[model samples]
Target: MSLGSAFQTLCGALFEDSMTLVCSAVVPESLTKKYRNRMISPRDPYSIYQLDSINSSYLLVFHFEDMPDCRTIQLTDMHNLNCTSHTGEEKNLYFGYSHRMCYNYTLDLTTELKHHCGARGYEENMQSGYYYTNHDPNPDIRSDVSGGSLLGSPTLVICLIVSLLLIALLHWKTSRL
Candidate 1:
């Protein structure tokens, strides 16, 4: 699958800029069913999560496929959803473009991008190796993608209850001593 044309042009404009802006993407398909159920809505393809320190905020889109590199996140599109106006110009909250990546992750101005994308221009400088594939960009996509809270799980509650009971038992035993 591929992204629409409008989304691609917008991505190019944002990435071409050297300015650093903070943003994030919400990929609901990244979470497991159990964890997803704990979320407000599970498997929501359109959900967006972000924090903004700049006047611009871009939403990087991706499409998932089942292949050898099944988890590879193909850059699909970008949406200029920034609400803040700039330079005495009206904020463009309705612009988009299509883009793609052979890599597993979408690079952006966030801690996650810093961790995966190298100092080299994000789209260029692919390292040559005898045993490397585009999937190397993100070998474990599902590991940390979940937004659900662990404390909301039933197992954690059971563990908490058991711990409280054990503490109460210990208190009683100490009083008897």
Candidate 2:
């Protein structure tokens, strides 16, 4: 079963106002603190906290404190979940609600919207999947070729010829010496 199901079972037993939801919300602050670094084993179903709070709009960012691969996702009107990574050292998620008195709007993470700073980064879908890292250029582009075939172009051919000629000249000079 997915994390959703485990959440349902645990929530039902723990909280009177329990509900099972996907990763589109929050895990209660209290629960998050309780299971800070606990590993969710199959035998120990309640080890992981289910973040299914659909009460407020919030932002959740997951990244290593020192790593550059910062992947952020926002959810609108979400419940709080208190779960951490298996190691409890790398994954960090934060949740906060809007305090603007006049603007009671919550931004949905699944929607295609730009940030306030004018940077365009939106979740492709409201579902969770593998995060695109800097190592993978053009994550949106997919190909079926294994190892990706390297196509030779005129520039590549010319560079190869130049490299070989330079190597031959160096070898000839060294031999004469």
Candidate 3:
């Protein structure tokens, strides 16, 4: 990559930030049936939850019993999903990126943390690690890429990748001259 091209990648990553509140769970067959193509309400704690800007990658270590890491749970790693829901059963959600660890209990998100999530029965799998991105559209533009989606929108990511490729190609051509 040429100088300008490299700068753009860095710049873009720095700017155009977005967020996504994704969630996962060791859901049972009963819950899985409901999750099939359904847009669940935030108050349903028994479902996969969503939150904002919590960072986690690879594994999300959920501790247990206030025992200081006595028990932990591991969650799979996926990019991220939009629909950042900071209210309801998911709020101030934390996450990890790649190699994370801990004693996480995959239980009690909906019935618990109702007050925390501003909803009554938010069954969030709060015990495991779940990273989220800052998707608030109105965040201060100058804020660093600290909060935004890694790949904001698939369409957007695709567009940016294409645009960067084009820019890099042009820069390479000019530099070659």
Candidate 4:
């Protein structure tokens, strides 16, 4: 089935409150193999991942909480879900996958819309699929770098002061001699 159909299935299965959704689809075996190691297993269903299998079928698991709006849900960023406004039509909802070097996942209000509550204008690209990261993805690490210079560090300032004091002592001894 297509990604659009899978999303439809997800909309139907969603309910009130927090829930874990497992949407299955018949994708190419190659696609499933590509993400096999990252696939979510039944043992750990909380995270999002594609199921590894011998056949051309795999399951996509997602964890989200229902929003106050009808049929609207806030998907966790940990799964690499990027929601955007449907091109041309602002009322529609578009979902896609994004992969970057770091596993930084944070909810951007600009990317998420309250109108996406209903899947009425929902659309997804066929290329979109689950993304897996072997390492820990921390968003704070990247944000912490403010483009400051090493000279701004306290350790460097202390070292500079000590060096200046040593130079003054050496000069005093030479003058006395």
Each candidate: what lDDT? 0.31, 0.30, 0.32, 0.30
For residues 36-136, write the lDDT of model 3, one tens digit per residue. 51422332222222222222211221221111111222221222222223332322222222122221444333323323324433334433332222223
Q: Against the true structure, what is each candidate's TM-score?
A: 0.24, 0.22, 0.19, 0.23
- How many pairs of residues collide in model 1? 8
Give the Å error, residue 101, model 4: 14
- Winner of 1 and 3 under lDDT: 3
lDDT of 4 at 25: 24
Query: Which residue runs does candidate 1 get wrong by more than 4 Å?
Result: 1-65, 68-148
Best by TM-score: 1
Q: Report residue 86 deviation for candidate 2 (angstroms).
A: 40
> Arrange candidates by TM-score, highest first: which order?
1, 4, 2, 3
The model with the greatest lDDT is 3
Per-residue lDDT over 139-175 for candidate 1, one digit per residue giving the tens place of the 0 to 100 score: 2333344547666789889999999999999999999
- In candidate 3, how many Å is residue 59 off? 12
Question: Candidate 4, 161: how far from true, in Å?
Answer: 1.0
Instruction: Report the Cα lDDT for residue 67, model 4.
Output: 11
- List clash counts for every candidate, in order: 8, 14, 33, 1
